[model samples]
Target: MNWNDLEKHFSSARLGRYRASCGGDEAKAATAYVNNMLLSEAMMPMLNVLEIALKNGIHRQLSTLYRRADWWEAWAGNPAFAWQTKEVVSAKAKLQRREETATTDKIVAELTFGFWSSLFNGSFQSVLWKDLRLVFPRCPKHQRQRHAISSALNQVRDLRNRVFHHEQLLWLTPSLLDLHTKGTEVIGWLDPKLVPWLARYDRLPASWDAFQPV
Candidate 1:
């Protein structure tokens, strides 16, 4: 029970009430907004993905095979689709959510990760990479690592699994900056672009690569 082992960065965050501002700095604002959206933003999408999924999944779909009145359906019908917790209702609901969301996660990985990581060969973030590309389309391109990106996304999916499973994520050092990158740990796959996003809104330092992976 050593209190010294714990280092906390999250202050109490009210649901959706958490906010940061870049004031009048548009450059700063875009970067911050994207970073928050990627991590926390993914949660919202995960909910829609699950909801739409529960309505549309094949084996588990709310069609002729299963209806909204079934126990499995009741399980999926719970309200806490995005939250991870120990309450029986939420835990069961989350499992249902993941069962549906995992497939789409795979789809996103295939579409974005390799192309995304190629933008950061020697350490730059997608935050700047994406915008910079938009600003400077002729910039030399980085080769895509299809397998690596796919693999990374798989890891990220596992993190998703843990959250939906309602397991204690206290040990998790999470940064929701990328929906496509993955590795053994979360930060290892974070894009530098996330830093600019964080900086834009949260006023973090320029060194986003410093966020160590656990």
Candidate 2:
């Protein structure tokens, strides 16, 4: 299809960045648009593994620290963790709305990635980080601080949001590569064994390379 067909179907607003990036070359812009989608698709496995591992690692630590499988209940009762408590309540409510029993596992699965990542922010440092840090045992002691882990989690969370929302990633090729590396590193920090296992399915590198200018 030609540029007119592409723009009409995808909308000028959506394709604007691709057109600009391609120097007004309609063909190149169309190719870049499609390549952007391919790159987004390729990043999914890495994002999936990172999110699951991070959440499970956090859940494991919190459960052990609080001495209960449903450790979020402790947070719900604490005023300092009011915000996190709201997230937990919301997740449970969502599960109940689906007619699910809202079991601990169901509630955990219902929670958003944002909920898990938000736990690393400074606001929860005193209340959660003391024990939460154990989630990243594979990380070197020097680099295993709350701020560093928070930054990495937030960055990967943002990338995951963008990818899931079908946003343009062509303009962010370099940063996207860095985010991919950071995401995988976080996964390894959670469990070193997962890195080689994940490598077998990762495709973002090849997808990025395919769309390079030269």
- The lowest-lDDT stretch of 10 consecutive residues in candidate 2 is 205-214
| Alpha-carbon lDDT, every model | 0.33, 0.86
Maximum-lDDT candidate: 2
**Residue-wise lDDT of candidate 2 within 1-214, one digit each (tens)?**
8888887999998888788878888788888888888888999999989888888888899898889999988775778778778998898888878888988888877888998988988988888899999999899888899999999888888898999999988777557788888898999899899999998999988877787641
User: Candidate 2 — which residues are off by over 4 angstroms?
Assistant: none
Error of 2 at 4 (Å): 2.7
Best-fitting candidate, scored by TM-score: 2
Kindly report which residue stretches of model 1 are placed more than 4 angstroms away from their true locations once superposed: 1-143, 172-195, 198-214
Instruction: Sum up the clashes in candidate 2.
Output: 0
Cα error of candidate 2 at position 173, Å:
7.1
Candidate 2, residue 145: the lDDT equals: 96
Pairs clashing in candidate 1? 28-200, 31-197, 32-197, 32-201, 39-176, 125-192, 125-193, 126-193, 127-193, 152-182
lDDT of 1 by residue, 61-109 (tens): 2223334323233334444321211233344455566774423334232
